[model samples]
Target: MTDEASAFVPGHVTGFFSVERTDDPTTTGSRGGGLALTDGVRVTVRPAEETTVVLDDVGVEIGAVDRVLDALGAQATVIGETDLPIGAGFGVSGAMALGTALAGNAVFDRRLLRDELVTIAHGAEVQAGTGLGDVVAQAAGGITLRLEPGGPMENRLDAIPARSRVEYVTFGELDTATVISGDTDRLTLAGEEALSTVVAEPTVSEFMYAARKFAREANLLTAEVRDVITDVSAANGEASMAMLGETVFALGDGLSSAGYEPQVCQVDPAGATLVDDRDVDGEITGRSADGSE
Candidate 1:
């Protein structure tokens, strides 16, 4: 078996989404539009006596990651790193699951096809209630339009085929399960309107406009994010709130030009991919430390 393997999965931020739920986990996901960021997660899998999961050096019990490992039927040490904050609309949980699946497949010689691996990770996310379309979006990259709601194999997706400099700042996190499990009729309706508007135009500027409208219509934007968006817009930059979190994302150098020191990254065109692995002769030097996800 390979000594270890690594994979990089992009962080995703949903601009607007319509919830779609079903009995089958594989068929359950969200119909949404979002951007995959270059500032994302990188995961490495190595053989270990027992299963262990760490994100940013912190050991966290991620149910989705556990489900992915269980599906692969392998116990290994997984180390994930990302500057993006989890539960703040950055798709950290989904990224970790997808990254682990990609790396563990090679580390354990599972040989699961990429599609199958994505489905596994997507299913895990859905079942765990950690995410819906993020795994799929992170897999596709760029500005993704989730045309249909399902796992990777069961879903339909398209991208804007464009890229831009992305900047973001998070005020805090939101409980996704609390929001998605509640009455989504209003949210869904507003989301559909926003999605339609973007689908018609399908440009970065339009996307930001539609997202801003969706946030207002759906009543999902926090005051802090709202102020941030206003600031960026006043600076003549496109900005909007990220769905399911108190995050403000802007195109180009909106945040910087607005005098906000937000994290900066670009739209990741490649999405998730496997990085080079370490050989048995050496070891992966990502030391385990205490931290949060």
Candidate 2:
């Protein structure tokens, strides 16, 4: 029985923002928040020797994995997996990376801070381009507002408590890389400007509202995306797409619409953990820590 840890999937608002390109990523800040929902991915880590590895839907990438191990001078294998829909604007990759990295640290018997873990994960995403500033939201969970040009280099970690419950209504997969690659310059500019606005006055509700308005004005939302979100809203859920495309998110809960059994999730303040007994069975057992039995 190998030791391991699993982290809960926290819904994150994967919205786009502007930045301040000052050759300093830390100067960046998030302009707004977007629809964040849950994807099922429980990242796990196992230790063997002095090495770290990451596993995911797109197979394993060892570059960042090795960097983490080398940086810590520790020995371990980091494993990550996400049933969380890929390209759904849910930040599955970022979550997977962060979860796997933490697992590696644990396996190596190293107790690094969450901010430290976030830094490493962000670096990995930057290299992979598999994510945007979404890594910040995914790592911090709840309503996370990141400054433009965010990264560990910038030392940015801001948590915004959501005034409302936000969820995502997924329609189809958005090719994240395609959107990013196709409009690199435009998006970068947009992101930078948005960040500047938000950094000046960062508030979850204000930022999100402004972001949604900007998205509409910029025609960033595709016809299909807009229609889906509109239709879903009539049934009682606010819907929005990921940065470029690929995933749509629906906010709020208790929604009963046909063809969609909206998954119920909330902000997981407790990021990730591991259970010693993997053999535990199907019956509902423990009560929620909040005593919501």
Candidate 3:
């Protein structure tokens, strides 16, 4: 019996975070986390002759998926695809890991609980140093507000009302591990302040404004990013630099006029979901939500 499942997750922008570490393993997670974006990653799992992972976009080996398979004591071929640029602060790595864990559990017939799967994926990301609170935020979906952090269930989450359009431009990539591992005292303080300010208002405009302040105070904005933000602002649009990447996310039009085409997306309200590939009695038999088999 060959079973298959697929999951799609939205990307996120972490305005700021207060990191925490623990040897207890069970009680480990981040704190004071931030928002989720609309564009993200999708992963598919199916039985294979051997365990393997293929990232369709970058063609790279996914250690996070490999780690999940190892922990579950199951082998499957996993495929991840993302329109969002990797390592450009789109939270692609976290989305990939979370989607893989969810889809692989279904393909392996593990029957793992939602929180359990999130823990596995979240742990893999933390160990890999690819992200901190992305797995949690993506798991919750929408414009997430992570009040407290750890894993899926362990984190306290809220959401702002979804915006109509979210747009972004990518010029290059940044090493997330290097940036996250650095001294973040000032960044943490700035993030805390931004979090407090946004929590009071909690509008998309306020969030973006707070995020831009955090970027400037955290010293994460590059010259190119700053220039793009300035140009977009001059054109009467709100924009902010994505955390840990050299990418700018603008809220409206006028970026195209600045010689940069923006990729427009909407907020994904649903987090990860299992794709029904119903193969019954050795016969492919299943009707999709749209009444297609």
Candidate 4:
């Protein structure tokens, strides 16, 4: 189940890359399902100029690609390029896996369901060492309580109520892998107790508390990181750091006051989508180095 690349920036909970499995059910507002979804920020990292790589777009074709093909016996073109900025704590590998699964599902006549696609996509991410909890958030969208990792799309996905939303603010750039690898404990925090309570707690209240706690941590929220959060928060936007310490995200009611301020609005409850549909005004085609278009 290859996936489209995505970013898993920091500012949330941390534990390195520990995967836990449990029998709890993740749902929201009486709506429920047996599926596990991930959350994170995702961006397309295109090169400043046209470029090419020498692999099978590893991000797009993880171990599950063969499984997907075997299940449907589908033959589709798997195209991937380093269009995403790596080492910046983005879930580039996760995005590739998810994107591949999404694309493969389309090409394979929809042999696998959406939940199945998510499972395959996540499997690929676990294999890669470049993710935090963003995969679960991005897969689930909105605000979520990622209880445990692995298998069958079983997670607690809660929609951000009308009064709740997120704001993503990035300041400067840092290598996500390096940040995590350097201190090992600098980015770690205790979200388990909080997450456990959040699962059955009121969505608004839980998020409000989490948002407050997230703002107070020092190791997770370094000085430089805090400054960005403070600037945005002072502007009436709630803020946090993205995984890898490179970017910061702020949550708020609305970003109208943040106009042209070089920050992205961070409230996506429906998850992320990649469309084959192109912008006629901005069509892009990736080619190999051999002058092949």
Q: Please name the candidate that would achieve the greatest TM-score relative to the true structure.
A: 1
Worst 10-residue lDDT window, candidate 4: 27-36
lDDT of each: 0.88, 0.55, 0.74, 0.42
Q: Write the per-residue lDDT of candidate 2 for residues 23-48, one digit (tens) a residue.
A: 33333333445433444356666656
Q: lDDT by residue for model 4 over 1-293, one digit each (tens)?
A: 33322222211222123224223212111111111122232233221122222123443434433443334345444444443334444454555555556655654346677777766665544434344345455456545455544533654444444323343444455655344335442223434434444456646445545544543542455676666656655776644555454555444432335442433333344554544434434433221212222
lDDT of 3 by residue, 186-255 (tens): 8778877887887899887887788889899988889999999998888877788877799888665547
lDDT of 1 by residue, 208-242 (tens): 88889988988888888889999998999999988
What are the per-model numbers of colliding residue pairs?
0, 29, 1, 50
Ranking according to TM-score, highest score first: 1, 3, 2, 4
- Candidates 1 and 4 compared: the better one by TM-score is 1
Predicted model with the maximum lDDT? 1
Backbone steric clashes in candidate 1, count: 0
Give me the runs in candidate 3 sitting further than 4 Å from their true place: 24-27, 32-35, 257-259, 277-293
TM, every model: 0.93, 0.72, 0.88, 0.58
Residue pairs with backbone overlap in model 1: none
In terms of lDDT, model 2 sits at 0.55
lDDT-best of 1 and 3: 1
Q: Give the lDDT of residue 260 in candidate 4.
A: 21
Misplaced by over 4 Å in model 4 are 1-90, 154-156, 162-166, 172-189, 196-218, 253-260, 272-293
How many clashes would you count in candidate 3? 1
